[model samples]
Target: MAESFLFSIAESLIAKLASHAFQEASRLVGLYDNLRDLTKTLSLVKAVLLDAQQKQEHNHQLREWLTQLKTVFSDAEDLLDEFECQTLRKKVVKAHGSTKDKQDPGVLSIEDVGVCF
Candidate 1:
């Protein structure tokens, strides 16, 4: 039960982060880079779930491992949430026409932002 719950949370987080838009606009600002890295790490975590689930129940240490993983997962999710919030902040700033100049491609256009990605 613990193993399944952990992996499912991991899977959901991965899917959430993976679904973000990393197009040319976001690429210029570097959100794409961070997103890519996090996605890769999450993908690796997802890949290991099968093996982890199989072993977690049998090994006493696996419960501790799960605890550690849960901590990491929580941290990663928080980071992603911060990243997303930053992105939205930028979009909001840009959409409000605060400092959206052509020279500042760092701010993704409102059109570029689709579903917080």
Candidate 2:
């Protein structure tokens, strides 16, 4: 049961990363180059998830390894979510600029409107 649960989570993470929104987010956040690497790593993790789960019940070492993998997967998911949030925050800030950024008498502050990344 535990193995299947983790397997499902890995599968869902892979599905989420494959979407257009995630691709766009990756591009926006400068992870475009690493996206393929991430996919490959996830594929490996997914491939091992079931096997580890099945063996864990009888093997102590495999069970410990799967626990570690679960932590890694959770952290990876959080990082991906952070990048996507940053992308969305950028879009929102660009779309609706601050009053100061939009106008300041006659001069627009380049610093205010500039995106660091």
Candidate 3:
């Protein structure tokens, strides 16, 4: 059960790493090379998962390793999600400009009309 779950997470992480937004975000943050390395590592891990699954039942150490791996994969997925969100947020800010840079067009201050209290 743990093996299959870990395998799925590895696959999901790989797919996220390959996404265009994630790539662009990673490159902007100077993580492109690191992410590339990670992708390669994930592919290798994925390949090993099938074998590991078959053998884990007979090996206690392997089962422990898979559990640890599952935690790492979960962390990686969360990191990717955060990265993607930041990327999208930046895109939105670029498109709409910062809130600090914008003012409510319909609202006016009394000073603008030189009103006396």
Candidate 4:
């Protein structure tokens, strides 16, 4: 009878140990799952940061191009203004030569026009 009692006690102890081991294993599994979730979150954050950096770089490049385009536009405007001024100057010189010729009754030669362009 004592042997049976001892065997029963041993079996109960083993059962308790098994239950504790199973609880510990479940806790470990939960911890592993949490770690896996954290890793995925970190990866997503890294991707977002990289994308933001690339966007910033692209914006910087666009700004630089805009500045260059503005400079080019300004230069084109200056050139057009210079061309208009030269054309007006030529027209004024031709009108002056025609008036002088009408007053003097002389044909105005190209050399007398003094127009360079």
Q: After best superposition, candidate 3 residue 10: deviation in angstroms?
A: 0.7
- Candidate 4 residue lDDT tens string, 1-117: 222333333343334323444335436546445434544553453444344444545476644644453454445445434544555555677777544555554766444775433
Question: Which residue ranges in model 2 land beyond 4 Å of their true spot?
Answer: 28-30, 99-117
Best by lDDT: 3
Q: Which model, 2 or 3, shows the larger lDDT?
A: 3
Badly placed stretches (over 4 Å) of model 4 are 1-58, 98-117
Worst 10 residues of 1 by lDDT: 17-26
Tens digit per residue, CA lDDT, model 2, 1-117:
666767877877788788788888778768877886778788887788767765777898888777777787788777767666666666767898655645757774544555333
- At residue 90, candidate 2 shows an lDDT of 64
Model 2 deviation from the true structure expressed as Cα RMSD, one decimal place: 6.7
Q: Candidate 1: where is the Cα deviation over 4 Å? A: 22-26, 31-34, 97-117
TM per candidate: 0.64, 0.72, 0.81, 0.34
> Which is the better candidate, 1 or 4, if ranked by TM-score?
1
Selected candidate, larger lDDT, 1 vs 3: 3
The 10 consecutive residues of candidate 4 with the worst lDDT sum are 1-10
Among residues 3 or more apart in sequence or in different chains, the pairs in candidate 4 whose N, CA or C atoms overlap within 3 Å are: none
